[model samples]
Target: MNNPTKEEIGRILKSSKRIAVVGLSDQPHRTSYMVSKAMQDAGYEVIPVNPTIDEALGVKAVASLKDIKEPVDIVNVFRRSEFLPEVAEEFLEIDAPVFWAQQGIYHEEAKRLIEENDKVAIMDLCIKVAHAMTKTH
Candidate 1:
């Protein structure tokens, strides 16, 4: 799969303000919660997009990407690789510019769809790590 260069990824992190975290959990022990909490600490607005949860990190959660009425800069996914294609399909219906699948999650079809639509497709990478690396100068 084609991945963004460090510079390009850095730019994406720097420019993005709002993140729609699909599959984010309300439980603090979950990796999704920890990483998303870190993003919020770093000044990015983390919008939880999970049908099961009511809220996470103080922000009210939306049932899905379609439920988020405001603009989203990045759609950061926490689901498994097998579920990516479906998320990618839903992502296409949104106005977001970036499709990011968290670490250990990657799907060729999902990546292709996102890139084919002219949006940034990032997979098998940790957004928190990217943000930290980029801020290190």
Candidate 2:
């Protein structure tokens, strides 16, 4: 997989304002929750995209990416690697510019699909870490 440069990651973080977090957990202790909370605290709009949850991080959750009415800058995924292809398919249907899979989650096919569409695909990376490193927030 091609990794984004620190500058590229910083550019994305600086340009993006709204993020749709797929598989975001409602529990505060969960990594998804913690990460999303951090992003929210950094002034990014974190939209929870999980069918199983009603809401997360004080924001009303949507069942899927397609359910989001507002434009999404990044589709931040927290699902396992095995589920990436499926999520990638759904991502293609949306207008988001970036597809991001959190740390420990990487799939070549998903990356191919997203990049094939001329969209940014970032895998096996933590958005928060990238954000902190770039100090984009």
Instruction: Give me the candidate number with maximum lDDT.
Output: 2
Tens digits of per-residue lDDT, candidate 1, 48-106, equal 99999899999999999999999999999999999999999999999999999999999
Q: Give the Cα lDDT of each candidate.
A: 0.94, 0.95
- TM-score per candidate: 0.97, 0.98
Q: Which candidate gets the maximum TM-score versus the true structure? A: 2
Cα lDDT for residue 46, candidate 2: 96
lDDT of 2 at 69: 96
The Cα error of candidate 1 at residue 126, in Å, is 0.4
